[model samples]
Target chain A: MNTADIKNEKSVRYHGVGISNGCVSGPLRFFRQRRKMGRIRACGDQREERARFEQALLRTREQLDTLQRRAIREIGKKEAEIFEIHAMMLEDEDFLEAVQGALDDGACAETAVERAAEKHAQALRSLGDPYLSARAEDLHDVATQLLRQLSGERPDGDLSTEREPYILVADDLSPSETVTMEKSMILGFVTFGGTPNSHTSILARAMGIPALVGVGAVSEDCDGAYALLDAAEGTLTVSPDAEERCAFEEKQREVNDLAREHDRYLRSLINKPAITRSGRKILIYANVGEGREIAQALLNGADGVGLLRSEFLYLSMDRYPTEDELFASYHDVVQSMQGKRIVIRTLDIGADKQIPYFALPQEENPALGFRGVRICLAREEIFKTQLRAILRASAYGNVSVMVPMIVSEDEVRACRVILNECMEELEREGKKFDHGIEFGIMIETPAAAIMSDEIAREVDFFSVGTNDLTQYTLAADRQNPLVERICEENREPILRLIEMAAEAIHRHDGWIGICGELAADLHLTQRFIDLGIDELSVSVPYLLGVREKVTECK
Target chain B: MKEFTYTIEDPNGMHARPAGKLATYAKQFDADIRVHAGEKESDGKRLLALMSLGATCGTELHFIISGSDEEAACEQLERFCRESWGRGE
Candidate 1:
């Protein structure tokens, strides 16, 4: 259908599966522009095919640049830069030569691009680095998207024209495409494929959309069926009975009203401490992973950054971030916080999170294997680089360095030794810093929690990583759905660990921060308050909710 | 021309709200306001450029202003640095 034809339609239904959260309602728009793909005859000579392949590559490069510029204009500069990386992929001589080789075998330009993308994707997957492997998926998606754009076929599907707010169903939406959707028009999202860790899901959650992912065939059944979606419950009903529709509508309204009321209350309490009626005070902090998150955390009323995941800086790069790169990143966070507290967790890469560039050995039981503080112990160079970066950043603002996955006092001491060494190195260089820059340990392992008293003596504070703690305490693999029920955040054992850790740290005159998904739990906010957690570090979006909960508890 | 050296005491450096606020302040005066860290210089009235400078806390920066109201621009920026950008104030 032509753009005008689709735009003029009053209402239409194009169905797929929902993958992420949130609802948007707006005019149905379709991005149907395709990239032009040059065809090569099957009997073409190697030289002829090679020339055609090069021409196609040049055209693809131009198309990518144009898309990238449009992306920059539509989104922000940072997001647009993601496309630049893809453009770099197109320019890789080795990759281009491989595609040319395929085209010389009598493959069309489209087939050659697809074949090359698949080969590179498999190679990346075999590398076994999640982030690097994920990049392979990104490369594959981008190449396919670019090829399709060149082939005169739209990779993105048509948007419906129905005025009524409806959920978008898709196989999976890329982060870039998800951002392009008008927020006003999307009612919600349902996808057949996508994990919570996917960037699209993260963005949807950030956008506050109710999303249900992995609902196998719901999208096909819901086609043109005026559906009702309960995102909180991860339920989608296609053509529900009248009563169910009425009930869902009422529930949606109630949720909207409550959200509005909560927003107003949070605005009123922005400048106020999260104190209960009984004068109990709780500090609300942000769990930041990157520099961008620091600004978001501050805007959401975070008094400081509770957990700055340092892995992002090391990932997606060719080598260890130079001290200058590290300094610049940390400086960005410190400057953005405007002097608010920033607790940075040193590189926590291990089994589950790997940096292919580092080439760490793959372990059978990665969870209990070489990771966290253990990895740092063996790879002192990587650890020291991070320490130096954090230390140099400390010279900038209220920055504290924390070691993750600590299991014993010795690990704490060893980390402290390296940190001090780095600090001493800086001191010898005549660099000034908060000599008393606070050092902390992530109490993820049960052994660390049990030995909190001893660890506390060596550090300034403790931050309980509830996500890992729950998994370890329950002896349940978090990724295993069979034991999902046992991994409940509000379970008795998890709460007790938090209570115990907080008490132990408090006895030593040390503070404790919780930087887990549990920190954002509305139901557990009061419990955290009661446990006397010095800081509740949550995702930025949950800051207001946490602030209100803290205030109401007071 | 007026130049002053200051440390970025505000956490998160000169980004987001602070950068926007500083940009607004810069536009109020008829000065050629520029912020420099090492070799990087940014338009003091543009938040994007200022943020790209990545000036974080404890990083020494030079605020250079020239033309009319140069003194006012320097004074305002200096005050922001010294007072911790009014965060939690």
Candidate 2:
């Protein structure tokens, strides 16, 4: 009844996941593309058929080159790579060979290009790799470009005519097409199908244009109608009445004011240390998995890296990496850190992170089965190799070694013994390493949190990995939606455990840090500060926000 | 023929960008450059062929250059891979 009333009096609404927080009221414009073409009745002449195919290729190349140059001028070279890839696809020997074979079989130029591109695209679709499978669309994109050129369809004849700003809508958009759009006239984008992680959404957010994606299809009849798109609210109210537009305009202004306020406040806290009113200072650190993200973390003013997963080294490899490979990778990251502490976690694989070479057995419950420190403990050589590499990398910067899924004191003792053995071996080999590198363990298990005093006595520090602590504490899997509320309602229990662990660690003169999902929770930032966490390590984007919150705390 | 092995160090590893760059670079040489990753071999001058190799980060890319200017192609391309594509870190 409420839905019916809202639809009747104000507008009909379409919902989607919003990428940016702004809102705009503008005319809606759906992207239209020509797909079906009249079949060409080719003469039984092989030479002319081949010439036609060749001409289409040349025209497509010139168009792509123009798009590439424009993209470089407007969006930069990185985005222009999309067109470069298309150009290469247009000239690929395999693709050309397929087209030539089709031409030899007396098919027309359009039929040959379509058949060849479809064959390759079908092969790619069956590859089962989501990333590689997406390339099938790129093939179709290039093929469509060639077909349009072959049919003498003029490009850019209509885009110049849309002078007024409109919220563009599409089923999907290639990166090149999105980059080449006139930015000044684009109010926003509303895609019928796109994830926030898609290149289109990322580009939209980077351009500071609000976008509503994964909204299902908007009817063709709704085109040119005035729609108020509230991206923060993830609602598109088509044909909105004056009252609804006024409400949305007021909401947009308030949202913009809040963002402006946050921006100004965050800038002030950038270089300054986040100190509470009681003179307690909190360290803002970043959790990263890849080396490329380190640059962004430092750019965002992270004091240090709290949790460098160190699994990227393992994940990137076709096989187990040699000690030198591991050391060289870590050395690059360590040097780039420029003396800031990088807490390198040892191989935390086994459960969901299994390599084929490891031959880990499938379990009924993989999360509860052999994982993290358990895998490292059973595979001591892999553990020692990582420890040796991290210790060696410590020569360049303030590097710390952290262990994950550690639930017992014995695991800590075993890891320390192996670390000590590795250190002695490195010393015996006349290799350089930092002798006093700090060692820490993730307090993720409820058992570890309860046994914090004993665990704290053995380790230099404790970083609460709240993600797993919440999972194990609540006995709920994060991937399961049925028990999501059970996990949410029981967050206080996890915080209480963190409090207990913090007290125990502080008693032992060991500083505590939170490096899990909870670390970025601004609402719980004060609660974390009250619990005596000396450091809060979040992802790159949350660094300043957490720092800003800390400064406002008592 | 001149052949050498270099491990791919870029995190994205032989994806579209690097593969396109590799293809474009190889097309400039008179020599035929064939790159092998694991069991898969690809025409270095072809983007789709190189991407089909699926050489991920840490996967060794073995390059074999043969024909006229093989020595120069081998020398320059090896240098390019080492300097530009050597380390994702």
Candidate 3:
């Protein structure tokens, strides 16, 4: 059928959640699941059922051995070991015991294998290890192979049989299946079912491959058809018309060019300072979530880390992370930064970033009530532990402590008292730390902005957290659709507050920085420089873009 | 039987690389090896089992080996723990 007829037949477009950024147009290679074989109930005899299972195991082992070798040559040694891991899991004594136990209980070999695999899969998943949980997929793969062999079903076709690099369209894929593929031949992934948090989603994101998940079924007639898999928008257009194909190709090229441009152009800017046309040198720093993001920030040419949101450590764990655990993570980040400034925001939780262990009381307005510095000031032990950890990390790098959501000079003074006490404790323990490490406050409230002149005198620096400042100043919820215009039209008020904070911090010979989404806004780059803001910190991805914008600005 | 304990030093804990290498190493000897981390006990020869222990940084792992080559297994695996495991910290 022609493109016109194909477009009219059934639904040509499928929608799903995009896993990563990118797009691809290629032949749709459907990863067909093996059709169910007729189940022949075993005679409830031990010998016969055992024989069937043993034979199935033998077949599976041979098949895996061949696949392992082929995969080694195709993908490389490291990825090929996935097959080897599967083989070891297949023959593990504990797993075999479960499988054979079910067979002994008169269940057929197929059901027995499925039940055993599910149990072990569940066990692995409960471990809370992302990689180990990913191994649960290996269990399912091995079990399916064994089941297929027991009923004398043919194995799935080799992807190499296809000539072109194909977009893998499937009902679903286990992490094992996703990793084991010849990643080069796989253009992208489109699955009929998978949530954003599914194992396949994790794999796709890790692999940096474009993927669309939860796209409903495609008709068999459309198999092997030329399709556009635009994961940037999470749409699959099958048998696209000439115009659609041309448009998709253009968009794909734009994405590729921009990605490559960011790498090549950004690498050149890494060692150079971000200087505006008028010789105003702006320090472009990064706002990172955790320690791992620090490495990427450094790679992207961050002058330093302006906002290390320390709440992530609290969020990722069940209970409060021990001071030692927190110290280890912070130390690694500090050591890697190599004397660069790392302004760590101390536990900006109790707002949207809630922890169940903290048991924060439910409020009508969580953002305004019992949050940030207020919570930290009330929960002395938690605040002290974090302060101690930040102090310890200061020994490794030029680490600064920043208090979030401070509305008064009193709160700043109180934090300084705790800060000095932490220093005293560290000193008493004979800990080698930077005693002169700068302490700062985040100007995130209208009250904080109003009182910036007084607050700046209490701290060594000021970082205007514009996201919260904007919302607070305009009295409009950022997430509320009805107040979009209110937030949109209120940029001038927030900038004026930043100007006040910058001026206040400057009066005391202290540096002021902006570490929020507004820092990445190209239009605001010039105003920030003109306002004498010392540093502008956005996320890692915007490090170069903001730097480029700064150089372009007068 | 011969047994020894080693603490996890890697911030990533007993992830794929260390677990896979530990499994491959444990399989070479004629010994039955078991590793206990917290409440989880894993067959040392099984990669997934070793990883399933969910041993984070500073987790103490006790390796128990029995059979013909228990002594050799302990010596080599202990060295592996010191050298290969918990690197890049």
Q: Give the least accurate 10-residue stretch of model 3 chain A, judged by summed lDDT.
A: A1-10
Q: Report how far off residue A288 is in candidate 3 (Å).
A: 1.1
* Candidates in order, interface RMSD in Å: 17.3, 11.4, 13.3
Ranking of all candidate structures by their TM-score, best first? 1, 2, 3
TM-score of B-chain for each predicted structure, in order:
0.87, 0.91, 0.94
lDDT of residue A288 for candidate 2: 86
lDDT of 3 at A226: 86
lDDT measured at residue A132 in model 3 versus the true structure, 0 to 100: 67
lDDT, residue A116, model 2: 90
Could you tell me which residue pairs clash in candidate 3?
A: none
Fnat per candidate: 0.00, 0.35, 0.29
The 10 consecutive residues of candidate 1 chain A with the worst lDDT sum are A1-10
lDDT string, candidate 2, A1-554, tens digits? 11212477447788888887888889998777555454676554888877877888887887787677556434434555678788889899989998988888888888888899888877665655455556667887888888787888753324546879999888767665676565667888988876775557767776668898888888788888899888898888899887888898899889877866767678667778889988999999998877867887887789999999898887667899999999999999999997999999888777466776788998888889999999999989999898999999999999999999998898889988999999999999999999999999999999999989888888899999988999999999864423545776788899999999999999989889999878988899999999999999987767887898888898
Local accuracy by lDDT, each model: 0.70, 0.82, 0.81
CA deviation > 4 Å runs, candidate 1: A1-176, A179-261, B1-89
Candidate number with greatest DockQ? 2
Kindly indicate the candidate among 1 and 2 with the higher TM-score.
Answer: 1
Model 3, span A64-174: residue lDDT tens: 876764443333344555677677788887789888888878888777888788888898889776656666766887888888888776656447567678888887776
Clashes of each: 47, 0, 0
